[model samples]
Target: MAKTVIVYFSGYGHTRRIAELAAQAAAADLVEISAEGEVSEAGWSQLDAAQAIIFGTPTYMASPPWQFKKFADATSKKWFTRAWQDKVFGGFTNSASLNGDKQVTLISLQTLASQHGGIWVSLGLAPANTKAATRADVNNLGGSVGALVQSPADASSDEIPPGDLETVKLYAARVADVAKRLHG
Candidate 1:
């Protein structure tokens, strides 16, 4: 099987929900990046074995959370070894504001993946910019480098927008498909 891992840091559970959905869709294992910096040895092994790595983070001040940055920094050893070179790399993010500078977050992620010599994947779905677009829209067109989920500040986990969830599922499937094709 083409192994895939979803590594993410969620602050308020919104991004966590999206990450879970992506993992489920891709049939991939999940790894939560915590502020305590606790990552299982087995998880690191799994990451090394995986064909694809998906990153999810909540937009903090128009960028990724510091915890996620810490985790990324810790990957330098892997980078030096070219461990992730040519692997499929995808990213997703959730933000409170509708236009919470999500592109900035994706740009940061893409830059990091580039440093590792990884292949970055975009959200593949089309933008939800047309007048026909509704809450039930499927693709999240014109989004950032990867999946982009917009949740209202007051919305609860159960209240996540369906459009965003659909976009994430589609993005995950695309990543899995790409990994399968490239690694098979």
Candidate 2:
């Protein structure tokens, strides 16, 4: 089986929920980057063995959370060693505002992956741009790469839109499939 690891930071539990769903869809291991900077040594090993790495974070001031950035910063040795070279990478994000500059967060993630020489994967699903698009639409628009999950501030856990969840699941599955093809 292709080993995969999802490293994420969630401030309001919304992003964590999204990450858990994606991990379940990918059938991959999970690693949470906490504010206190805690990650298991075994988790690091799992990450080294992983063929794909999926990240989740909430948009903080139009960028990823400081904890996520700290986690990335702590990987400088791996980055210098090119540990993630050719590995697959995908990510999802949640924001309170409809136009919460989520794209900026995605761009930051893509830039980090590129620095690690990783292979990036997009959602590969069409946007819901037409007038016929509905809440039940499989893939909503605006995300050009990976999955962009939107959750309103007042939305409850059970209120997460099906479309965003489906998008995340599809993206995770695609990343896993690609990793298997590349590493198997």
| Best candidate according to lDDT | 1
Write model 2 residue lDDT over 23-120, tens digit each, in one string.
99999889988776556687788888899999889997899977888888987878999988998998888887766898999888888888999999
Lowest lDDT 10-mer window, candidate 1?
A: 135-144
TM-score of each: 0.95, 0.95
lDDT of all predictions, in order shown? 0.87, 0.85
Report the lDDT tens digits of candidate 1 across residue range 1-184: 6888999998888988999999999998999887665567877888899999998999989999888998899899899999999999999988988779988998999889899999998887768788878866765436857988888899997788898898998899899889999997
RMSD values, in order shown: 1.3, 1.2
Q: CA shift at 115, candidate 2, in angstroms? A: 0.5
Model 1: colliding residue pairs: 126-141, 127-141, 127-142
- What is the Å distance of residue 127 in model 1 from its true position? 1.1
